[model samples]
Target: MATPLIEICVEGIDGFLAAQEAGADRVELCASLVEGGLTPSLATVRAAVKAARIPVHVIVRPRGGDFLYSEAEFATMLEDIRILRGEGVAGVVIGCLTPDGLIDEARTKALVQAARPMAVTCHRAFDMTADAGEALEALVRAGVDRVLTSGQRDTALEGLAILKRIADQAAGRITVMGCGALDADSIRTVRDAAGLRELHFAALRTVPSGMAFRNPHVGMGGTGKDREYELTLTDTEAVRATIAAAKS
Candidate 1:
């Protein structure tokens, strides 16, 4: 039963070519997903890594609330992870904390050793940790390769029992991704009760902005939710029916 990987949280390059033509398997790449995601313009990560074929995990997040950062926003997140590791892009979704929450581990192990060999996720800020099994063992001692939780509750099937106790305390040493508000009927119940191999979502919807002219008043994301003409992409058949309901 091994088929669950399906990551998909896009925002640019047309939601990363509509989540890689609706097959997704990876494609976080972000930028102002309504302030929940930021950082996304090394020319839209080199045009989604030259219109990638899969794997495109970008998201250095310079802003959008808090994960605590200051020294010049952690040196602009280490020069945006050395310019998205020289645009070879394949990973980088970081997190940093410590205004007394934990897991700052020297700026998260110096942004996971400057994101070498790419592959380094830790979004959802690990659900704003206060201690999810000590921030999943401080993101497996700061070498994090994955994590995009919802087990902090608010979705992911209301934190499917803390994502099955952080996937049984990450028995596989890290890679539990069961995101919030997952769709296609809740992604096979949070990937079979959180034994999840990996799965994040964003099969968005909300279209309506081929404006020909209409200014009823005003509202440019000043938190009034007028959403300039509205448009939240990523819905290639709802990412092909949530990857065919996580492979049936």
Candidate 2:
């Protein structure tokens, strides 16, 4: 048996380079981690693609509020995908939904069509849909290459059962990449339980806040936490452990 391949999500240029150095098979590039994740700027995407030794997949999210997109937002996403495709991204990650939490087939199909040469990944918005089973079929029908999900749970660990079922149901018709709260310690469990051979994680470790002083006067009463940025580097130890576990 072989170790599962890892896809690391990088929030910036540094993380992208780090992931490559740490031995990631691929990198998913995005911005605005605080709002979960938003599509990165063209400059950032281009820089990562140029710096990375591995494939770089750009996230095509226009905003962070919901998977449902307005006409304007959809247009923006389409344009972003076009620009990213031109910039030489290996793939594009995106998801769209209807107000009722079903796959917005029309919108998703359009995006997939626009992302022609580059592969398309349906992002975690799959967890937001009413039916994971139905959504999987919809995505397959729409011609998506893969899906990034946490098993429809808050984290992949909790979603392993469903992820396993999804993997079985998909039957290689589409790829399911388990993401969210994935680290070295739990990667093996997720892969074995989900019966998958590919895994995704940001491998993010918290960075020290540069702020030296606390602001006590602001209504939010707490230690003024220094901002934490997701390091672009992959955690070599975590990756090695995950690989070892997967092989075992």
Candidate 3:
């Protein structure tokens, strides 16, 4: 079998360069990984594109929480796609679902049409759908290039059965890229077992802040965790290890 394409979900230019350096086949560039990846700024997108040797796919999510978007938010997504297309990105990852958990084909098709030659990937919002098979068909009809999913489960490993079924159901009409909680050790099993040719993971490791002065009074995120003094980055060795394992 051929080596699986490894896409590292990265936060900024730092993470993007790290993934590329570590031999990632591609990268999904975003702003707030803690917020599950929002649309990166045009500056960030330009820097990554200028520095990238591997393909860079920008995530066009306007906000976090649910995949449902208001009309205004949908408009924001379209404009972002237009800017990213001009920036020469390899693709865009987007998702817009109806209130009842079905693909918003109208909005999705519009985004796809806007994306043009650049590929369009339906993000994990596919997992939030009521039915995996039905959602896959909806994406195909919408002319999406691929989908990122975990079989509606929290992690790809846990969702192996449905992931495999989705791969089989795709039947060459669409590409099924398995993601969620995958890593170097488990990637091989997930790839071979789920019958996936592409895989996604963060490979993030927390590094303590470099600040000399420690302010122990206030935390930034308001979640009550002291992550203010820490940074999450894609570990180069971790990416290489995952690629090696998936290929071996």
Candidate 4:
């Protein structure tokens, strides 16, 4: 069997470059992993496209939360896609679903058409569909190059059975890339268990804030209104270890 490509989910330029240096085959560029990875700015996208030695696939998610998009939001997503396409990104990762949890075929196809000549991956929004098998067929019809999913489960491990069925059903029509809450062991487990050819994960670590003066009064994030200053960055060592472990 061929070694699977390790596509890292990177939030910033550092993570982008770190993943490449740490043996990532490609990167899914986005921002604010806290919000489940929103679209990065044009500057970030441009820098990544220029700096990355491996393929830079931009995530075209306008916002986080749900896969459903408003008309205006959808328009904004298209503009972003237009910009990224012009910037020479290797591909665009996007997905549009109707309120019923079904693939918004018309809209999705339009975006895929607009992103022509560049790979278009229908993102994990595929995991939210009414039916995985039915959704797979819709993605194939929409002409997406691949579908990133964890078998509609929180993690790939939890979805191995469904993932295997998806891979088997794909039948080479479109690539089924496994993603979601994957660590080194889970990465290899999903790949081997589901027979996936590509895998995605984020090698993130918490780095303590450098500010000596701590402000406890205000909170930057979290539900308790506590201003936690620790920042999460992609650990190159972690990436290297995960890659090595996956291969091992």
Clashes of each: 0, 2, 0, 1
How many steric clashes does model 1 contain?
0
Q: How would you encode candidate 1's per-residue C-alpha lDDT over 124-224 as one tens digit per residue?
A: 88788888889989889988978889988889898899889988989998888888888888899889987798888888888888897868787666765
Q: For candidate 2, list the clashing residue pairs, or say none.
A: 14-232, 15-232
Tell me how many residue pairs clash in candidate 3.
0
Name the runs in model 1 displaced over 4 angstroms: 1-32, 37-66, 69-121, 124-137, 141-146, 149-171, 176-196, 209-217, 222-226, 231-236, 245-248
TM-score of each: 0.33, 0.89, 0.97, 0.95
Q: Write candidate 2's Cα lDDT for 1-248 as tens digits.
A: 45777888878787777777777888888896666678888888878877877889989998778898889989999999888878989999999999999999999999999999999999999999899999999999999999988989999999888899899999989999988788767887888788887788876666554555656445332323334312234466666565556556
Residues 1-248, candidate 4: write the lDDT tens digits. 68888899999888898888899999999899878789998899889888878999999998889988899999998898888889989999998999999999999999998898899998889999989999999999999999999999999988999999999999999999998788876788888889988888998998777788886677765554332666779989888988887777
Which one wins by lDDT: 1 or 4?
Answer: 4
Segments in model 2 whose C-alpha atoms lie over 4 Å from true places: 211-240
TM-score of 2: 0.89
* Cα lDDT of model 3 by residue, 90-145, tens digit: 99999999999999999999999999999999999999999989999999999998
Extract clashing residue pairs from model 4. Answer: 219-227
Alpha-carbon lDDT, every model:
0.86, 0.82, 0.92, 0.89
Off by over 4 Å in 3: none
The superposed Cα distance between candidate 2 and the true structure at residue 84, in angstroms, equals: 0.8
